[model samples]
Structures are given as C-alpha cells and as structure tokens.
Target: MKQRLDKAGVRFRPHFKTHQSWKIAEIFSQEGIRQITVSSVTMAHYFARQGWKDITIAFPLNLREMDSILMLPEDVTVGLLISDSSTASYSFPKSLLKKSVFWIELDTGHHRSGFSVADFHILTWVIDKLCSTGAHLQGFLFHDGHTYNATGIEEIREIRYNTLSRLSLLREFLSEKYPGRNFLFSGGDTPSCSQELPMEGIDEMRPGNFVFYDLQQLALGSCQPEDIALSVLCPVVASYPDQGRAVIYGGSIHLSKDKLTVGKETIYGVVCSEEKQSDMRLTFPGDLPFLTALSQEHGVIQGTAEQILNLVPGSLARVIPVHSCLVVSNMKQLVSADGTVFETLNLHSVDF
Candidate 1:
C-alpha cells in the first residue's frame, strides 16, 4: 500500500482498525508511516498512548465520546467525522471545536452515512454548521465502499473516477464560496486504493482493508491472493471424508459472518492447509474445499471426496476470511505465520 500510495504521491494514513495491534503498527513505523486512522475514540486513545500523534477516527462522530476525545494529550491531533448538522452542533464544547479537525463524510453512492454530493443543501448545511462552531473544516471524505460490489478493475476504476469527479466539483463549489480557504479532501476504500487509479483531488488515502487483503478484495481484483496477510486457524473437530464434509471449531465468533456467493454457492471463507492459502482454490459450486457455511460455534467445510480424505480430526485447519477486518475485530490477538503473538485493543471489553 505504501508503495502504491508513495508512487502516486498521496499521503498514507493507514487505518489501524484492520490489525488494531500496536505491535503491528511498529511494523508500519519501520516502513515510515507517521499518520494513522482508527474506527473509534478508544482506538485513537490506544494508538495515541502508543505515541501516534496524528489520528483520525474515521467513523462518524459520537457525541457521547466527547469527554474521552478531550482527555487525549494536547499534542495529539484528532480528526472527527460528522455526517449531519445535529451531530455537529449537539454539544461539542466551543473550546474543543476550536482545536478540532472536522471532516464531513460524503456519500458518493454507498448510501451508508454522510451527505451525498447531490444533496448539496444538507451537505452545505452541515459544513456551514461545523465552520460556524469553530471546527477546522477538513473538507470532504468519500468511501468507495460500494466498489466492493463491482465485477473487476474496470468497474473499480470507474467508481474511483466518478467519486473523485463529484468530490472535485464539491471542492470547487466550496472554494468558490470560501475563497483562499484550504480544504483538504481525503478518503479511500480498499478497492479504490489497491488499484492504479489517479489520485487527483484526493489529499490523503486512508485504506484499512489493504493492510490485510481478504477474499472479498481478492474477488474484486483489488489484490492478489498472495497479498492477504491474515487467516483464522480452526481446529478440526470432525471429519467425514466419504461425505466430503468436515466440521471445525470456528464459526461466527471466530471468523465473523461475512460471506460471498458466486452462482449457486455461498462462501464464508476459503479453507486451506497451513502453507498454501490459495492452494485449495475457491471456485463456484464445484472446485472443492471451502468454508461453505458457518453456525455460531461451528463451521462446515465441504469439498470433493479426495479433497478432505486426508483430514485428521485432531489437527488444525486454516481458513482465509472473506473480510479480514471483521475477522480481526473478533480476535483478541493475532498469531503470525511464524507463531509470534501480537496483542490488539480489546474492544470486546465490557467497558467499551
């Protein structure tokens, strides 16, 4: 990701929500990444304590977390996301707003959060409110999350172009309205950042999933199969080779419930040996050996007769998740390929 972003001359503030491990962040620091992004104020707190000065909480601003946000060290710069006017004016202290970096999340057709570029009235209203409240207007942010629905690179590139064009027009309009004001535009979805698209109006790229490409990104042509950096290790609890089925001690709790369906088959994950994640291969309906269905505490692996004939019930099974971030979110820590242990922020805590 740094290679692609550096070559394109775009600032890389990678989202730590993918790994959520401060130890993993050390690896990023070794590669010269100073700025970062997270999904919650607690994450910002975790990384801030790790000495990350520039932190952007990419999720929408939570009015309840104002106290926690304000408690951070004075030097730490926090960027908050606001999707509507109410959140902007609800109860942020004027002094906090004075030092805050406000980002208006833009809905470039994902329909998730934020004002759509077409809904200029609400968007403009939110922007005006934030600016009036003394928050530093940090310009627009668009997540091409919809790009995940694309068929290939061409579709992803098209989404990227269209989003940037819409954002550019918004930037122009804002600049014309407020001359000499420097509004920094920044946003990135994994699919958009993984490709060789042009970074024109974008100021910085904050892509989380790119850090650990998953089966979803792989299917979208955003990354190669080898680029995936994380997988879940499930213990084989039952083996039925004659029935071409196996049961593993991994389910929604371990891998999350994210899945991908191609033609007649639904894939929760790709089950493979320890060495070759791509070796078992995932094809629609028939190529064999995929994590076909998942229950709360068990996962069903289905394949051809020979595919699972060698399985031993006591052994461990490796499964590549469809969405790495969701899988990582469920894990309390990460076990590397080399058996190294890495700790992550425990969002599952009762306090969180």
Candidate 2:
C-alpha cells in the first residue's frame, strides 16, 4: 500500500484509530510511516509520545481538550479536524495555533460529519473565523464512508468520483479566494483507497482499515477474503447435535455486533476452524461453519453435520470478525500471529 502511494506521489498518513497499540504502531514506524491519523486526543498524545512527529486527530476537535492539545511538545506536530463553524469560535493560544493545521472536514455525501458541499456558506463562515483568529486552515479532508456500503467496484468508483468532483470545486473556490496559499485535499476509505480512484486533486490518503481488513471489507469487495489479517479465537462451550449448532464462548463483545448481509441472511461473523487457525488469513472455506447469532457471551455457529461434529467442548474455533476496528477497540489484549500477547488501549476508560 505504501509503495503504491509512494509511486503515485500521494502522502500516506495511515489512521492509527484501527489499532491503538504502540507495539503494533512500531510495525508501521519500521516501514517509514512517521505521520499518522487518529480519532481522539488520547490517541494523538499516545502516538506523539512514541516519537511520531506528525499526527492528525481526524475526528472533530474537542474544544475541552484545548489545554491538553496546547501541552503537547513543540517538536510533535498536531493537526485537528473541524467540520463546523461552531468549532471555529473556540480560541486557541497563539503557540498552539501556530503549530497546528486544521483540516476542514468536507461532507462528500457521507452525511456522517463534515460540511456539505451544497452548504458552501458554512465552509465560508468557518474559514472566515479561522482566518480572523490567525488559525491555519490547511485544506479539506474527506472520507466517503458511504462506499463501505457499495457492493460492486463500479459503485465504489462512482462514489469516489462524485466525492473528488465536489472536492475539486471546493478546492478551486478556496484557491481563488485565498490566492497563493497551497490547500490540500485529502481523501480515503478502505473501499475507495483499496481500489484505484481518481487522484488528480487528492493530495493524501488516510486509510486505517486496510491495515487489518475484515469480513466487512471482504463483503464490500474492498479486499479478497485472503487479505483479511485477523480473526476471533473462540472456545467451543457446547454442541447441540440435534440442532446442529455449536455454541462458542465469544460474542458481540469479542466480535462486534456489526453485521453484514450475505445473500438473504445477516451474519455477525464468518467461521473457520481450529485446524485452519495456523493460517490466519481467512477464506471461509466451504467446509467451515458460520456464526448465525451472537449474545453477550455466546456465539451460535451453525454448520453441516460433518462440520458440527468437528467442533467439541474445549476446542477452539476461529471466527472472522465483521469489523476489525470495533473488535480491537473493545478488547484489552491481542494475541499476535506468533502467539505473543500484547496490551491494547482500553479506549472505553479513556477520558477523551
């Protein structure tokens, strides 16, 4: 992924919100990934202290964290996301403002966050406030999250093109008004970034899920099933032969409640087996089962007679998570490919 971006001359600022582990982050650091994007101030501080020189808290900036953001060491560059004019009202210390870049989050039809393109008035209002306060309005940052729902490559391409087209118009407008100032347009989402998208106007990519694709990505066609890098290791607690269901000791908490519709059925996760556990890459082989339902502590996997017979009490079953980010976020620890255990950020307890 880095090679592809480097070849295209697009800056890679991988989002760290997917895996909030410093040890996991070192893997990227070793690959020359000095800059990163995160979702929270806690994550920004955590990565900054680990010697990451550039970090962007991609989520809308929290006004309450101004003090903490100001306290960050001068050597570490921090960027903030501002999606609305309300955020522009908060005053920042001159020192902090000088060291920060504000990416105006553009709503490229995602409807989740950012100012809508049709509502250019909001963008103008926010820009005016930033300029008045001497804040650095870097450029536009976008994530076409709607692409995640796309079922085909062409649909994804259409969504990406629409987003870029809107961004190009906004970029032109910003350039015309603020002459001679370089304004960047950054865009990313696994579905759009994993595939080739129009990069004429986009200056950078900030994809986080590509680091750990999941069943959701597979279903979205963002990646092949073999590209998925993680799965849930669950213990088979009980087996009901009459019903042909194997109950596992993993559920919504372990594998998030995120569901994907495959055919007519909505599944929480795809199931693999203990025998194939050594091969972490999940293909959801035909012989494997699937998690049909999940409770807080129990996951019910249904399979054929041969498959159900294979699962026994005290045995382990591997289930590919629907969403890797939510699964990792809820967990306190993770087991690596080499069977080494490492702690993950307890995001639930984090103040931010």
Candidate 3:
C-alpha cells in the first residue's frame, strides 16, 4: 500500500484514532509513515510519547488544552486546525507561537466548522490574525465529511470534484494574494480518498477509516468487504426457535448502535460464523431477517428458525460494525491481525 501510494505521488498520513494502539502505529512507522493525523490533543500526547515526530490534531482546536499542546516537543512539527473564531487566534500560548504550525480550515461544502469560501473577508482576516501571532500558517485543511451521505458512486464523485474545485480556487487566490507564501491544500475523507478522485490541489490526504474499512464503506463502494481489517467477536448465548431470532452478547457497547440495512431489513452488524473464518459469508437470514436492534448489552438478531438452528451457546460469531471509528473509540483494547491483544494508548494525562 505504501508503494502504491508512493507511485501515485500521494503522501500518506493515516489517522491514529481508528486504532489507538502504539503497536499498530509501529507498523505504519515501519512503512515510513512518520507523519500522522489524530483527533484529540490527548491522542497527540499519546503518539508523541510513542516516538511519532510529526502529528496533526485534525479536529478543531480546543483552546482549553493549550498547556497540553505546549508540552509537545518543539521539533515534533504539530499542526492544528483553526476556524473563523477569534478563540483560536488568541488561544495558543505565546511562548510556543513559533514552534507550532496552523491550518486554517475552509468550508468547501461540508458546512462543518470552517469559514466558507464565500466568506473571503473573514477568512483573510483570520489568516492575517494567525500571521500576526508569529505562528506559521501552514495551509488550508478540509474534510469532505458529506461524502458519507452519498447514495451512490456518482454522488461521491460530485462531492469529491466540488470539494477539490473549491479548495483549488482558494489555493490560487491565496497564492496570488500572498505570493511565495508556502501553503499546503490538504483535504480528505474516507470516500474521497478511497475513490479515483482528482487530488491535484491536495497536498496531503488524511483518511483514517481506510485502515480498517467497515461495512458502511463497503456499501458505499469505498472499499470491499475483504479490505475490512477489524471485526467484533461475540458469543451466541440464546436462540428463540419459534420467533426465528437469536440473542448475542454483543450490543451497542461492543458493536455500536450504527446500522446499515437495505429497505426494511436491518443489518446492524454483519454476521460471520466461526467456521467461516477463512471464507466468511455475511448472512442475514430470511423470515425474521435482520440484525435489527441493539440494547446496552444485547444484539437481537432476527432470522428464521432453520437459519439459526445450528447456532449454539458458547459459539463465537464475528460482527462487522457499520462505523469503525465509533466502535474503536468506545473499545478499551484491540486485537491485532496476529490475534495479539494490545492495550489502548492513553491520549491526555493532564487536563488542560
């Protein structure tokens, strides 16, 4: 994958929030992935302790964590995201102004936290303020998060094209106005990064979910089921022969409440029997056909009596979650590809 990315001239900075394990992170590090994108300051500290030199906290800056931000090494090259608010402008400790890098987030179309391209005055003012603070304004960062709402490949392509076009226009404007000012145009979302979208203006791509593609990504055409690298193992505890339903120990706490279904059938999670490890077949039995509902500690799998007759107590079933990000964030540990248990890395030790 590294060679493939290298051949495409796309610099990779995988998001560590997906699998918060230094051991998994070490794998990427061995592949020459020095730079990484994390979601929180706590995560930054965690990875920093793990010897990651270049880290970007991809989420909007939480000003309260300024002290934690300052604790990072000066040579580590930390990059933060800034919105239009004056909060971020004065949030950073003046002592580390020169040590940190900043990325002014632009709202291409995601309408999340960034200033829109149409709000040029506010953006320019924010840029000027950031520059005045003596901090390096690295570039513009954007995430086409709306791609997750895409219904098909065509809509996904439109989101990708429109996002890049807006960023490209902003990049050109920035270049013409502030000539010779080194600026990067970084943008990414799992769908945009995984697809054959044009990434000409994008300097760096940050796609976290690609590392462990989930069932939602598979349904969206972002990745294949084989590309999914993680799955939750649950023990089947009971079966209702008459109702054609089975109860699993896994619930929202383990597999998450996220759902991905077609029409009336609810496939809250993909089911894989233990026997089908090498060739896993995702099944949603007919009749009571659905991995329908999830409570705090149980997942109600609705299916036919004959379909679930073979499932017995103590049997292990693999469940693929709809969203890996939410699942991993809630889990305390992760099992590697080799079936080794690794403790989750703690992000922030001290409150900011």
Candidate 4:
C-alpha cells in the first residue's frame, strides 16, 4: 500500500486501527512512514507510547474525551477531526485549540458521518471560526466509504475519479474564498487507495484495511488473493464426512459476525487448506471453501467429503476474515509463523 501511494504521487499516512500492534508498527516504521491515523483517542495513546510522533485521530473529535485528548504526549502532533461548527466554536478547549490541527470531515457519499459534500457552509463556518480563534486548521478530510459497494474495478475507478474531481472543485472554491490559505486535502479509504484510482487531488491517504486485505477487499476487486495477510486459525472439534461439513471452535467472538453474500447463501469467512495457507494464497470463486454457519462460539464449515475428512478431529482450519480490522481487535495479538507473539493495543494474545 505504501508503494501504491508512492506511485500515485501522494504521502502515505496509513490508518493504524487495522493491526494495532506496536511490533507490526515497527514494520511500517522500517518502511520510512513517519505519520499515521487512528480511530480513537485511546488508540492514539497506544501508538504514541511506542514513539509515534505524528498522529491523526480519524474519528470526529469527542468533546467527552477532551481531557484525554489534551493529555496526549507533548511531543506528538495530533490532528483532530471535526464535523460540526459547534466543536470549533464553544465546546473546544481554548488553550489546546490554538496548538491542535483540525480537519473538517466531509461526507463524500457515505451518510455515516461528516458534513454533507454539498454543504460548504458548515465547512467555511468552522474554518473562519477556527481561524478567528487562532486555531491551526488543516483543511478537509473525507472517507469515501461508499466505494465498498462498487461493482468492479471500472466502477471502483469511476467512484474514486468522481470523488477526487468533486473534492478538487471544493478545494478551488475554498482557495479562492480564503486566498493564501493553505489547506491539505486528505482522503481515501481502502477501496480507493488499493484500486487504480485518481490521486491528482489527494494530498495524503489514510487507508487502514489495505494493511491486511480481507475477503471484502477481494470481492470489491480492490486487492488480490495473495494480498491478504491475516486469518483466524480454528481447531476442528467435530467432523462429518457424509454430511460434508465440520464444526470448529471459532465463531463470531473470534471472527466478528460481518459477512458477505454470494448467490443466495451467506459466507461468514473463507476456509483455506493447510497447504494453501502455507503459501498464503486464497481462492474466492468456483467452489472456494467457506464457513456456512456461525454462532457465538461455533462455526460450521461446508465443503466436500475430502475437505471434511481433512478437517476431522483436532486439525486446524485457517479461516480468512471478512473484515481484518475487527478480527484483529477481537484476537488482540498475532502469532507469527515462527511462533513470535506480538501484542496489540492493551490486550495480549492467547499464549499457546
């Protein structure tokens, strides 16, 4: 992903919420990426303690967590996201407001958070209000999350193209109005960053899921099978060869309940053979293995009789997650192939 961004002529400040492992972060640092993005203030703390100096909390600024937000280590330059004008005017801490950089969140099409793309009133209002108070305004940042539903690579490219074009227009409008005001346009979720999308208007990208491409990214055409880097290993407790299925000790708690539908059936996760997992390759079409059912603590894998026989009694089935970010949060730590256990956030992985 860093190479993808570098090729697109933009700076890479990837979101760290997907892996959240300081040890994993060491890998990113080794690649010379000095800045990062996170989902919450607490996550900022986790990475900050690891000596990450430049961080952006990608979520909206929580007036509730203002205390903790302000207490972040002094050396770290924190960039906060704000969607409402009120967060810039009265509620924001006056002392910290002057020093902190604020990025106004604009909704490209998601409708989840951020001000509407059509409404520049809230954006200009917040910018002027913050400027009057001597606050460091960092221009516009958006999450083009709607690209998750893109039909194919072409559709994904178009969605990203249209978004960058619109954001460019807005940047010109703001530039003409403010004259001499320098604003950095930051955007792009995994879909846009991973696909062959336009980056002419994008200054930086903070894509988290690209770090560990999942089954969802595979379905979106944003990543290839080999790009996926995370999976949950489940132990099969029972198997039925005649029934062509096996029950495993992994479920929603281990792998979040997120799923994607193929044909009329739902797929909770992808089931991979031991040899396939060793090579780190996945097959998503034409009789690809998958989990058919999931409860709180049990998952049923439906496959051929041979597939079932191989999973019989105490064998391990590696299941690729539909959402790597949620799975990482659930598992909390990662065990490398060499049996190196890497801790994440505040939780330790189950030591074997």
Quick one: best lDDT, which candidate? 1
Candidate 2 per-residue lDDT, tens place, 149-189, comes to 88778999999888778877887787787788888878878
| Cα RMSDs, all models | 1.8, 2.7, 2.7, 2.9
lDDT of 1 at 65: 82
Q: How close is candidate 1 to the true structure, as a TM-score?
A: 0.94
| Per-model TM values vs. the true structure | 0.94, 0.92, 0.91, 0.93
Candidate 2 wrongly placed segments (more than 4 Å): 274-286, 347-352
The deviation in Å at residue 108 for candidate 2 is: 0.4
- Return the top candidate by TM-score: 1
Residue pairs clashing, model 1: none
lDDT of 4: 0.82
| Candidate 3: segments with Cα more than 4 A from true spot | 274-290, 346-352
Q: In model 4, which regions exceed 4 Å deviation? A: 277-286, 346-352
Model 1 lowest lDDT segment of ten: 273-282
Pairs clashing in candidate 2? none
In candidate 4 the C-alpha lDDT for residue 279 amounts to 48
